[model samples]
Target: MNTPAHLLMGAAVFGRPAQTKILLAAFFGAVLPDLSLYVMAGTSLLILGISPQRVFNELYFSDAWQTVFAIDNSFILWGILCLVAIWWRRPWAVALTGAALLHLCLDFPLHHDDGRPHFWPMSNWVFESPVSYWDSAQGANWVAPIELVMALACGVVLLVRRVPIWAVPLTLVLMAAEIWIVRQWLFFFTNS
Candidate 1:
């Protein structure tokens, strides 16, 4: 998934919020998985920034990215964040973890090359199908199915919780918009 998809997932989980720190924590938690890639591409940069490649690599092992951040790490991190948030962020932890977990769940359909880490530490497994972008469909991978799910799930929960009924319609619209956005981003609008 791309950054927009991540933002969409995070937004769906934690909508326009009334809280700040919780929002930051959740936002960071949701993005933590991608940070692994930065670590990978960035081991060198960090070596430059911090001036120590061996120490940086030793502090955060390369395989850790392959295992922890590669697959389901965001969900796991969100779980820990949720528990930790309770001590600091209270009920907001619910929203925070929701966004973070949703980030991973959203990545499910778009996982590139079937190289998804669903079980994380349990297995460096990758799930791919012709239906998914991971199989490298004809430029169809840009569409973020997770956004649709997130919007739908958020709508359902909002309805059940009696959140503003207006949210349902709005979310449905968002889903459609997301599909088009993904298609455009993956194929048309983006520089291929």
Candidate 2:
């Protein structure tokens, strides 16, 4: 899935009670982690390559540094962060965490296909995705197709669930477009 998918999923998850403000917040939070992938940061894709994803993973979620954290799985860190965020009463905590979690879950399916490290330390377990290696331009197998389908499904569910009618079209469009954009970036530029 792309950033838009993350945003949309986050919106769908956090938009409960259906507030436009929450939906908007989750959308931004979903893509916030990608700042690490920008080249001017001196730590973007040009410098770190695909490991850019890893850096983002660790920047906010991975508990790789703590003796007691043992964050082999990102969810634990997210859960902990949620607690922290809630304690601080951060309005964006749930939305941000939802976006981040969606990003990780989407990556899980893709990681299996690309042989990327999903288990980190637990052992190489493919979630059985046929993605078979990550690329920026040409996503492995039918990633674009799959992403499109899922994005559409999410849109329909969101709409049927009575998400504001006006919001539906833009979210739907953004989700589809973002998938294509990320697919291109991950496969095409990464190779360059």
On TM-score, the leading prediction is: 2
> What residue pairs clash in candidate 1, if any at all?
113-134, 116-126
The digit string of per-residue lDDT tens for model 1 on 6-117 reads 6445754675452455445445655666676666557655555544555345534456545645554544545666678666756556666667677777666565453446
**C-alpha lDDT values of all predictions:** 0.54, 0.57
lDDT for predicted candidate 1 compared with the true structure: 0.54
Alpha-carbon shift of residue 147 in model 2 (angstroms): 2.2
For model 1, the superposed segments whose C-alpha errors exceed 4 Å read 43-64, 68-77, 80-89, 133-192
| TM-score of structure candidate 2 | 0.56
TM-score of each: 0.54, 0.56
**For model 2, how does the per-residue alpha-carbon lDDT over 1-192 read when each residue is reduced to its tens digit?**
565666666676766556676666666656654433333224444565536555445533333222212232345565566678778876667777666666666766664323233343454343656453344334544565566566666666677777766777877787667666756755564645
RMSD of each: 8.1, 7.1
